[model samples]
Target: MTHPALIPGIGVEDTPRVFSTNWAVFGIAGVLVLGVVVWGFLAPDSISAAGAASLGWVTDNFGWLFSLLAIATIGFMFVVGYGRTGGIRLGADDESPEFSTVSWIAMLFSAGMGIGLLFWGPAEPLAYFTDVPPGFTAEPGSRDAMLDALAQSILHWGPMAWAFYALVGGAIAYAAYRRGRAPLISAIFRPIFGERTEGWIGAVIDVFAIIVTLFGTGVTLGMGTLQIASGVEVVTGIGPLGNAGLIVIITILTAAFVVSAVSGIKRGIRALSNINMVIAAVIGVFIFIAGPTLFLLNMIPASVSAFFGELWTMLLRNPAQGNDAAAFMASWTNYYWAWWISWTPFVGMFIAKISRGRTLREFVTVVIVVPSIVCIVWFGIMGGTTMLFESQGSGIADAGSPEAILFAVFGALPFGVVLSVLAMISIILFFVTSADSAAIVMGSMSQRGKPEPSTWVTITWGVLLGAAALALLLAGG
Candidate 1:
């Protein structure tokens, strides 16, 4: 990377020469994010295909590396949490927590995995039920397969994934708050280049972080759009929406969240997070009560046991071993890991923002333990309902489209349309929470990691996210 230490003092607030808010960083990062969106808009097929190709090659060639990194994440956190460093706070010794424990955990959990769980809670189990991986689980459509489906879903979203996110979050928070540095990726590399983290070298690192944030935010909006659009069609008993319909949904969502971004965190993010969590919990409870209540309750133990029992196989299985296993790993395991990594920059930063004043031990425990519990219960209820629904000949397991599976699960219940509408609204709100936080974080990075960035900057990032989402939808995201 380029080192511009020759042209600057420490790159922080009050230093006119600090590269943290330099025009070069903003100009380069902005152009990169906007350029990708515009290119995808104008030439979506090629851009989308190229992205797929690059990711595909990485999965095929470096499957072991991703798996190693993921497994290592678990070990890394244990070391941090169990060692003496566990007692260290993320912020200064005298600084108290800004939010209560409950509110803090709620916001982080919502941003970390709310939309994902909404999108995947029903779909992944159903998908696994349709086609369990060879040697990893039993035959599809069997009782054993049902157990494996829930187990696999929990594993994918379980502690391993959360640990990966915590690793990044802890690093950023330690660098920014504890060390009194800007919340930039370059700050994390202080051990290697202590003073140069404030130069163009740091700016280059921040630029990559910005691009990752942009992609994660944009693709998240697009995928959430697809799910809700299909959901609305199912609930209203209308035909599938065309591209124009999807565009309208995106536009409205963009506007609502942008308004929320400008409304400030209290009026926007915190409110949405609390409300969405209640709606999601209600939806989960309804599914459990109305559907197979006892079967899902029974799954809680079996799923957790299976995940721990088979953690090694699931962690290490890859395409290099055999054809069937390879294809399965490539699609499911590889997809999940890559998706989570892309989300780390923005999601981890959000986690960091809300995670100040907590010890490393407390933060790691909450991040890994709470989300893992939520996901297992979520999959157990949602996935177990799918199995019960399928037993009655609903064909929910064969829905083919993942986005449609949640609505299909709700279709079996009495007042199915009403249930589906609840799901749709909850999902939109969950997505809005993510978009709003990402916009604020992106603006924060562009402006020297201010806790609250300018409204105009936040709106600019939100609008850019909308455009990217629309373009990516066109590009087959």
Candidate 2:
């Protein structure tokens, strides 16, 4: 194992002391995360309401900041990839990729934003289309309405989101692998901090990263557990899965993540990712063949074109212009940007962890392009199929909740029940993969970026994450 002092490429005098400093961070962060979880359990409503109010204030006041940073992040990815620095390497001059390109992409894509698409891809477009964004949305059930809705989904889930992640991942990878620093976000500030990178300031940065990772992972787990519980109710004809049922679901799924996390990334994360891709492909294929195949095919180009065509308008539209715009930004665009930003340090480092030995250009291109294109296609097919239902008044857009939208679409297909079960399985696996990957990132950061953190640390994070999710669900979020 590389010592923290030796991990710093320069100024290595006190390795042991530096390791102690990092453990101090680890202890503080763990305690803080547990504290928040306990607080949520004791005062669920107050915590949830307070957190929501804080988020609302930021989204309302700093809407421009989020929009500006998003566009700037995208531009940075493009410039860094094709500029003079295009040929820069992430590691040693002659180093090669740690995993095959396919496996690497699968792992990152799943970790980055896979399971959310199971719901949002179908739900968001339809939701926006039905209510419309007020100022720009088309007439309900019109052809233009279809275009507008698909375009909105494409934009929200497209290249821009991935670009934020690509830049963060690129910076971390270059800093850690090339500069020979621990794979912590703090390491990226080494130029400024130098020896101070091993001190309190650096510890603060890592602590913030860990807290964000823990809370973000908790949110994912909570949302995913609720969705899984709902899907179970759908497939098994089970009762409405009250609070008790949801807790049971969280416990079982959390156990799954703990096991996968402890199994080690090469086996657990990778295998689950392969299965996720296969199951996702199964659903997509089944929908394309069984649904409005031709219209869905046509939607691919139409949605892509419309997304780019309306890019500037969507980017610059002031959310405060009208009630609809305000609600849309608050509920959709603002929330999306916030979640993406919070997850960046976690997902970025996870990407960087598996991205050693790839060139800067290769790294950026794959990070920005592949997931973006995959998102477009997934939304196109899934959203397009749902539109066929909505255009004829299928009521899917007005369904129980966003998480239930995909299952609603499946109900109309042959062997719908079986496919829905597979989907629920896919959701479980995706969350498992994500939580375990996040646990690895948190564990690695806490351990001074050890390539392989101890299994005990990994398991602890996995279980704590599950407990945090249980807390959130109990809190009525």
Candidate 3:
């Protein structure tokens, strides 16, 4: 292993420290996350209400800040990746990447946005088609609605979103690999905080990282479980899975992630991420070939073009448009921006860990550009096929719920059951890969940025994440 090159005067030791856990951060963050879970268990109503109130207050007041930060972060990534520092390697000058280029991209793609793309691939576009955004005058279900729907959907899952990940991930990678700092969120601030980073200031920064990561992963965990339940209903002809069933699903998948995490990154995360990517590609190809082949092929480039064309309008949209526009922003754009920001700690740290030995330009390009392209193509095929069906008066836009939309689209295709089953498998594997990396990241954080945290610490975080997901579902989040 290449030793981390510690920057002098930052207070990090020249030699790596061996410790079971960094008690301050571990105990504090763990207690807080557990506290929320306990509160949810005991008073689901109150906790959910409090959470909703908090979210509303933040979005209503700071929504503009979120939007500004998103656009600015995108610009920042470009400048850093292409500026004077662009060619700087994240680690020792001569060090090559620990993982191959293919594996690197697969792991980052899987951990960063894999599950989300699958969940919203069809639902988001169909949503905008049925109910167009305020700025657009397109009639719902019209050809214009089809173009605007895709543009808006791509905006949400596109470059700006990944920029948040790149900003945090790139900064951390630079600090840890390039400067030889400990890989903690707070450690990145040594230039600002100096030795204070070793005190309560650093502790606070790390605590926030841990909490945000837990909740970010928890939200996805909840969404993935609901979708998996929907898949179960579609494939096995079972009825809706109530909270109890969701908990069961969480329990089984939580075990899978915890085990994978314990096996280490190279053996478990990389292998599973690669396999999941292949499965995802197969599903995308099947949709393109089996659904609306020519339409999907046509929409791919059109969607890419539409995304750029619609980018400025969507980003500039704020509360000024009207109450309807403000409501829309709060409900969608602002909410999504907040979700991506909150996820920075988790996704950012995981990417930084895997990104050592890459130049800043390479890091930024892959982290931002490649994933953005994949997202555009993905939504085009999944959403395009669904829109084609809807335009033909298939009533898929009125499908009872978003979770069921993907399955409904599949139901229209040949061998719908087989497609649904494959989707479920992809989702489960995504669940494992995301949660697995998150557990390891949390473990590393609590252990003061140890590259490989202890197995017990990893397991503790994994189990807690599962419990948190169950609590959120029980609370109707």
Candidate 4:
């Protein structure tokens, strides 16, 4: 066996400066993406119908699998992190983290769940509060409802979600740094495929990763665009901008992220993520202070407790709970599980890139625990405040759309327009950071895990990502 140190792309000096392209993977993914674009444009209604049906079928039939997979991932991470492998480093034992703890965390939070938290923080809890899921008896506007809502929100965005990312990210990092394999998803399967990992099997795996990343990114970009569009209408006093407007916004943001992606990870991704974290913190603090301060403080712990107390119930929910429970799962929990799984490829790869030199335990702790706490706090504040508003008849729940709920909550506070504007900026920045990271991951995968994929390759992936998002938007979403 070749020693890990002698691998082709093992170190900075030995790494190839060129693209070292995997044309098979790149070409196949490109063709498939192009087909999606053409289908989306030529038959948008059909695309929408097909997408809805596919999502429905998966959520209804395979939701149990999603739920089972999520909990199992969490348990697997715990066992792996604390077991004998806990002390093993992702890189050389003497190596240190490439980025500071704060920066690394900011990137992880940003790429893994930034836009999602921004878009869903207030909306989801309020949603659950308005209509409690089956098997829960909390009154719509009661304190119990508020706690349950927050708990459910945490369930979706917290540990169960991040575990997927940590598992995939840890596997990729181990394969690349410890085993001296290329960083491709295929490389991780080498234990099974052996030498065939370098053949069609490897190309197939990489291509699958690219497609998943592309569409996963498209789903997230779509959310950001919708929220931004809603914000634009709120700030400008303009009417709804329809699908055409969504496409235009998608184009602009896509261009921005493409530029950022080509600027390299250390410079563009890190800087924007750190700055965005600061801005997000400012926004969060402002909301906590300007909203019901005491209620938020009280709800934070209450919600965290509620989440843990009910964690198993939420995790084990399935069709057996009855039709209503199954329906709820299809719409919410199951859907989120599937979304997170779809996203692990890109988010996991990004986490792996910045997470070298950490022990398995350390990596798991940071990736799962830290982000889960962030989500819990974020919901406790944003969702808790929104619930407070609704209970007081502020009508925040009537915000017409989930994307507009945060702005509606802002409208009830001082400096409403100012908050809305800042919220818009934050969403756009999060959108860019996530997209840039996805682009880099796709580029790296296409080039057989080159650490620094060629700039044009990154650009190509970015443009394709935008195209995929645009197609979804044009298909009525």
For all predicted structures, in order, the TM-scores are 0.94, 0.94, 0.96, 0.96
Which residue ranges in model 4 land beyond 4 Å of their true spot? 1-19
The worst-scoring run of ten residues by lDDT in candidate 3 lies at 3-12
lDDT of 3 at 341: 90
Query: What residue runs in model 2 are displaced by over 4 Å at the alpha carbon?
Result: 1-21
lDDT of 4 by residue, 1-477 (tens): 965433322322233434489999999999999899889989999999999999988886787789889878999999888987788788766778889999999999889988999899999999899999876778888999999999999989998899999999999988777666777788779989899998999889889999999998898898999999999999999999988789789989999999999998999999999999999998899999988999999999999889888877787777888998888999899889889999998998899999988888999999999999888888899999999999999999888799999899999999999999999999999999999999999999999898888998999999999998888877887
lDDT of 2 by residue, 110-208 (tens): 899877888687888788677766556578777777788888887788888888788878888877776666778888888898878777888899999
For each candidate, the alpha-carbon lDDT, in order, equals 0.80, 0.82, 0.88, 0.89
* Residue-pair clashes, model 3: 1
- Candidate 3: list runs displaced more than 4 Å: 1-20
> What is the lDDT for 317 in model 4?
75
Q: Over 4 Å off in model 1, which ranges?
A: 1-20
Instruction: For candidate 4, list the clashing residue pairs, or say none.
Output: none
Candidates in descending lDDT order: 4, 3, 2, 1
Model 2 scores a TM of: 0.94
Q: What is the C-alpha RMSD of each candidate to the true structure, in Å?
A: 4.4, 3.8, 3.0, 2.6
Q: What global local distance difference test value does model 3 have?
A: 0.88
**lDDT digits (tens) for residues 293-323 of candidate 1:** 8887787778888887877777767766689
**Global fold similarity of model 1 (TM-score):** 0.94
- Write candidate 3's Cα lDDT for 149-245 as tens digits: 9999888988899999999998888887767678889988998999888778998999899999998998998889988999999898978888778
Q: Which pairs clash (backbone N, Cα, C closer than 3 Å) in model 3? A: 5-180
